[model samples]
Target chain A: MRRTPPEKPADYLPIAFPAAMLGLFFVVPFAIMVAISFFERVQGGFYQPAFTLANYGRFLSAFFGEILVFSLFLAALVSAVCLVLGVPFTYLLTKLSRRVQVAWLIGLLGVLSLSEVIIGFAWSTLLSRTAGISNLFVALGLMQQPRAWTPGFAAVMTGLVYQAFPYTVLVLYPAFSRLDPSLGEAARTLGASPLRAFLTVIVPALRKTLIATFIIVFIFALGAYLLPQILGRPQHWTLSVLVTDQAIYQSNMPFAAAMAVFLVIASLVLVLLANMINRREPAS
Target chain B: MSGRFLSRVFFAALALFLALPLVVIAGVALNEKKTLAFPPQGLSADWYLQIFTDDAWRAALVHSVLIAASSALISVAIAAPLAWFLWRRVAPWARIVQVLGLSPFILPPVITALGALSFWATIGLYGQPWTVVISHGIFFVSLPLVTITLGFATIDREIIEAGTTMGADDRTLLKTIVFPLIRPYLISGFAFAFVLSLNEYIVAYMTIGFTLETIPIKIFNALRYGYTPTMASVSVFFVLVAVTVFGLVARFGDLPKLLGAWDEGER
Candidate 1:
């Protein structure tokens, strides 16, 4: 009687309200995606209900697997680069006066709120094949137009870094702010250099934020489509791009569905593993 | 450390990185020549005129606005009730309900898009803008739910106790005190959801099936064919709308906190 509450319509109504609506929207959509992957396309591009593993087998294909590998490697690289770039910037922001902190926060917020597509478009112009920033580089004898900057792996990496950098900085800022000012002061008083104190004291304390920021950044970067699709070499496509290419350009819905499934699996595995490791250790 | 010197250099670099792209885009938009060249042949907002005149581009902008506005409303309405339930119920299932709300944000959008596309296709709900709104809405529902949850926690429990002592039931208390106070959080949540939905491309592009294009689809198409003067203008337009919308939200809401700030107590 203590364990279970009296049955009343009002008691469960609130919890049940969202459960039903959420079921209709989120779970059902995922089910359809999975179900469609196993079906064949009929005449006129309509989905035909037929059980098949042909779609799932495409994941083993060299072409699809290659793109997935490239994306994973690139995503990992960008995540690292974002952390490297973000930590210092976040440190700088935290050290600022309150008004300055607010100002700096505004800038970070602006970038965070800016869409992935906007960043992609802007970066493309700045590094366009011809008659753009790369062209300016050529005119100044810096590099040539139709430069190796855009439409390649390097460009995609750059864009992903730019997109994820703000999140990294924002996440790291709090960790940095939470640092004890007097610890660094005491270290300096005891003859430790600023850099040494930072490396020993500040860095260790930031481990949790570092992990959290990295996971969140990785999640966003890995799933990101626009930056890679625009800037990446078609041959060096991200899984997100591959999924879109298959679904939209090739009209290979089955193959696309397969790619989307693999993408989610990759993300889920990483998130679960990170959480497990974090829970076990408590901190790095 | 030469703190001031290092800070200045870092900040200047950041500002340039943030500003240069927009400056280049805006400059190219004004180029009298057809190509998107900087140090333009001449300056004019002719490209802006071209943006307004382009039927496909204009259609996409309209679609983006409509989808964003409607989705924000829908997400907020549903998330509010769900959050209220979770806060009041405190049952075992309430935790599951919160996770359900947040799961979409954690899950890859591509996977979500795929599922949504398939789901809609099977139901023959494809090509309808409402489908896009609902699909994005479910994902964005988490935003309002989070805000309202935080607001609920922040409210002075004693004030609500006082209200209850004054003969307020849950419904009356919600109307008299809870709703009025958390209104800012609610508004901010709506704005964030609306802005993000407007700017979203991958989901919009995949689910819309080429029958309807958003501003992002137009910019994407423009990139594929060529980066025309007009498209540069479109980029400028996007930046402006993004800046204004984001500026308003940051002004009214805890933008950094939403980005997962750690030192909110100090701020």
Candidate 2:
């Protein structure tokens, strides 16, 4: 590698602004949150500075434990479903013409950038009795009546899957596009069926990418807050939803902070694991 | 051939599945009545018009735009120099700085939002609109950091060398050569953060709460009460904004490359 000239003292000046901003906003706040997580909850829904593991210990209780377990399960399920559907779809997408690919990319980006609030709202409407797909079934004589599907596990799953599908595709796009087409062709020449070729050859070859994508999607889905509230019953709420409810409605900032801290640590570990896997995957 | 036909059908079905909710929302926005109906009891643009005409909804729209525009600008401002420093220097701390800049985005927004929520509350800045702007600016800094880094990577080393050889100073080289090259990247970065910030809910809600009625907050508050065609209309409007911004990015920038596709030469 070519060596550039040495930096001057003034070169450090550019970094100072962002450093200050992030340090003040990001670092300080996280520190405060960690501190608050250990603080004591006082009367009247406020908290005071103190050392206590009570907030974290509450996570061991049935209610909080259930939410934590359910959050992880939902995230894992969403990730798996998205990868199963998205991997194939993205691979097929790469085979299309560039113009068509760009159009699809735009559509995906639009969906990906859209607010969760809007998507939850849209799905709620789509799953409602008046505007839902069940109405179409009723119109075609396939059903006797329209049906409202919100406030259920299936509805929450559908909303989250829809929200996560775009991200899954976007995350997997580069890997799928970069895949050497001749590998599949070679498999085909060996008398392997197409499905067999995909199963045996392509899937294994991209295992690391697939794993990384799964973890990324998992982290995203685990943090879903609005969809559960809008589409599911209170019993189906995720940790994120509970965190918000605790802080805002229940006015328990200490517990909310503890949950948030746990979420951050969990995400960081998964991210590190993904990084290790990617680093070890002999750079293609 | 049978397998190929099956794959095509599968792709078409998935596309329809992806589009179903969006199509439903659009249909519902056109309903004449207040009730949410897909096939439309009647047709009217009144709800769409009401987004701008209604006081609460209009205020929310203005607040969303304000937060998005200012936060995007702040993001680019912070991201540009940080990316430049990383590109220009080869120091160990540069990597750490990059990680710090990117960490807010990589972690769940809820964690970052909670942190910001507490941070602001501690400093007595809670519920302030500018807190939302600054928090989002820092949180979404990774967008521009990635794009601008990509921008710097695309800059030819020889061009900078030539400028230096021709007696141009560091300032001149940056102003003439580097700045012009990265302009598109900066704009795309701004656009990406703008659209996302405009549509963001959790962070905005956590930081500013209901004090500033961003479109997402307004919609959520409204939903807790009941359904409104106006909410659907705003959603449709959001989709249009997102699509338009991304379409422009695709047209003006190398969309595939920005999206992580390997370069044509590399392939």
Candidate 3:
């Protein structure tokens, strides 16, 4: 073998600690839990290390299928909602003067800066009865009572939309801001109608960014914790919530690991698919 | 004109939607009534005071800060070397290790939580504060790494040569030149990791369960039993802290540059 050139070395001690931490705390424990799922519980919540897919088979439970489908629906819904709300502003912001663009960027940065937990707490109070600004519909005599927003599906949608929209907007903003605006204007000057110009020229220009935003938001909504935790009812759970309940409450290590593994696999698929689609995108 | 109107309304509604929650949480914190209420009957600071007197809340708050600071330091320490590798190494195994280092962070929290839960259990480190700090550090590794990488990438190649010709070794060049240039970015990245670790509830929850609760977990538990005005007071306190921190950041740092979404060189 040819000799390699000498170089300045990286600090192995620094990387070692975190890698070991991930291995010990994150990788190994999950491995044990996954291993346990196959065997029936023996004692002290420990299962004799035995291999069977029977526990995985239990995922055929109607609840598992139902939750999985509902989670997909919610993910798609949240992604679509964020896309709808995000696209126009991203376009408009890009079109605006730089000063205005920075103002909006700063605002979006603030929203994204706050933690997801705080965002959940904030929305819960906003939609809660009596004082929730949403409840003002009742006070104004537009409705009879404060809509049962939280601990329900509607609130789950609201929370997911809230959690992921800023991300969608932030990501898509750059693609829009850096877009070649003259192309769209040229299309208009060439006698294309406004909608047609947008549809044909602007749409294709934005196609990759939209796809990236959609995939990111969908995966994010799929794995969301606090939004659904605070907003959704107990039975109407996301895979994240369901896995959490299983691990912490039921102490069903194997089952929880199974669900968590499923979530990871699903996220990986979505992200990879997005990457493939993005790579296939043509130069604008 | 209609398109402009539509766009304006879209952003207006979005702004309202984002602001609404903070407003209510602050309002609820001021309720004079004992139970958590909307349209609180009157105003009071009792709940805010309660946060000070409550021992459990105090302990959780202290725990959160300690972990967040420790985790930030740990993340920076880890990131520095990783950034060095990413900046220098192009070898295949080196690349794989790089991805592995970031996998837990780039992936979702739920997946990381699941992995960490199992990872911690076997090592008998599952519920310790150190475990929480370590988990947090792992989760936020990419932020500091990316920031420092940016800081490193921006350093003109000639500067390193300039130092080397002055007879400086790698260590001296790094300490004397590289560190000073990236220090602000390092601080911002560290702050980002610190805030995120402090606010992260799910990882802490799955790993720690009730063995120890961070302030967010404590608040979550409190809400499960029943919402209290004191909870609102805590929310308000967080807002105050955010405002105070941002104010200091504005004073000591260029807010726009720190965010990393834009460049200082850009208009």
Candidate 4:
């Protein structure tokens, strides 16, 4: 049961600042962005407020279609990789002592808050020829010689996965930490093997969270603007990278706004779906 | 037993994987040559020194700090009241307001960045540093909003009742009680927004373009031309700042609680 606070004249006072700021900045900008998406792009690095579908029509082109498909595929791969690795890691993290868990949490937070630019630079160096791990492999006679592995698809995937891994763990942390340990113990007592107990108990228990986590990570990866540009070839560029390029380099504001509008709607739909799944799950 | 051993190995490998890039970057930062290389021919602190001494790098660092600090203040300013209002008053519209506060972060940052870009352009405030500051402040308000809300929830209702019985009004009680209690949450929230704003690239880039060079924008520009050990040094510096900030948060704050881990005492 919930009790509503009594309506007071002063109640509106505290909310005034937030409403003004968000309304003026966030709401207004997004509205403008949407409106601009419908405008026509003119020559000489400008656009007009005239009605035109040509911007949205660009989406039908093979170039835009290919980029969209690649973006979706790459995002799916990043999310799947994060989920596969993050779930078991988070589960194991819960099994650790409190002090160890805090340390791990700190590490995760540190990585999570780090700028994408730094991560991209770090990965670029790590995957570079002169200082790359391939050199270590060569030293151990596992490979013929050192070679750079970046400026390609694998580099982009690795960077995105690394970037997303911490987020996945953080989102799953609350649920896993709150999970009832007795359920697993009971399964074990019923002659289930350890892996079987985990499969039958833990995985099913967190199914909703897993689904939501998958979609959330999917959304995050889809909007990776920096990593793909830094690590991947042009063909591997995600829609986000292309959006920045078009908006900045190509100076095509209308087309860029249209693409961004599409990205926002897709992300919005996925987020709503995740929320729906989460709401469906009974409160712990 | 094998399963346990293998799992341990996997976890170790994952940890190594996470640390490897940072370690490599640190090594590259210490290299003698200007090239981004490990196993340096000789050690040199020149690149690290260069971050402070060089004009472009130094200006970007200072600019990033300025934006981060002011934006963090603005974030707390916007979030504190809204969260306080929600805690003190529970209207139906409270949920809508809360959602609005969080919306900037929930969507992809690129969307938010584009929106800010167009808005600034429309208002003829494009290419202004203040625009980036405000955009970042608004963008990261969700951080402090969540933290301060958590702070308010931890305040026991009985305390408010006791204060009222003592004839303390809303203003006095808030000043004496609520403000003192939520100070740590406020600090943590500020710290979060500051560090993130410092690290943010896209919003800052889109709003102000190259007119104002933050560290990320500077790094991206440098990366476009070529790699340098100086970039690695800056990367190392950033990692240190992130680690130190988060390490303090872990030490002084209820980090697990902040992260939404279930109460241990309850279990």
Relative to the unseen true structure, what is the C-alpha lDDT of residue B240 in candidate 4, on a scale of 0 to 100? 85
TM-score of chain B of each: 0.91, 0.97, 0.89, 0.96
Q: Write the per-residue lDDT of candidate 4 for residues A1-284, one digit (tens) a residue.
A: 12348467766888889989999999999999999999988899888898888999999999999999999999999999999999989988888888888888888877888788988988988898989889889989999999999989999999999999999999899989898988889999999987888888899988998999999999989978999988999999989998899998999999999999999999989999999999898854
TM-score of each: 0.91, 0.97, 0.89, 0.97
Q: What is the lDDT of candidate 2?
A: 0.90
Higher-ranked by TM-score: 1 or 2: 2
In order, the Cα lDDT scores of the candidates are 0.75, 0.90, 0.72, 0.89
User: Lowest-lDDT window of 10 residues in candidate 3 chain B?
Assistant: B258-267
- lDDT string for model 3 (B196-237, tens) is 776788888877866887877877887778677776777667
**What ranking emerges by DockQ with the best candidate at the front?**
2, 4, 1, 3
TM-score of 2: 0.97
lDDT of 2 at B155: 88
Model 2 clash pairs? none
Per-residue C-alpha lDDT of model 3 across residues A144-255, encoded as one tens digit per residue: 7776567788888988887788778876765665566688899999999766787798877778868877988888788787678787787668888887777777777777
Q: TM-score of candidate 2 restricted to chain B? A: 0.97
Ranking by lDDT: 2, 4, 1, 3
Tens digits of per-residue lDDT, candidate 2, B1-267, equal 998899889888878887889899888889898978888779999999999999989999999999999999999999999998778877777777789888987787888888988998999889988999999999899999999999999888898888888999878988999999999999999999999999999899988886889999988888888779899899999999999999999999888888888776877
Candidate 1 scores an iRMS of 3.7
TM-score of 3: 0.89
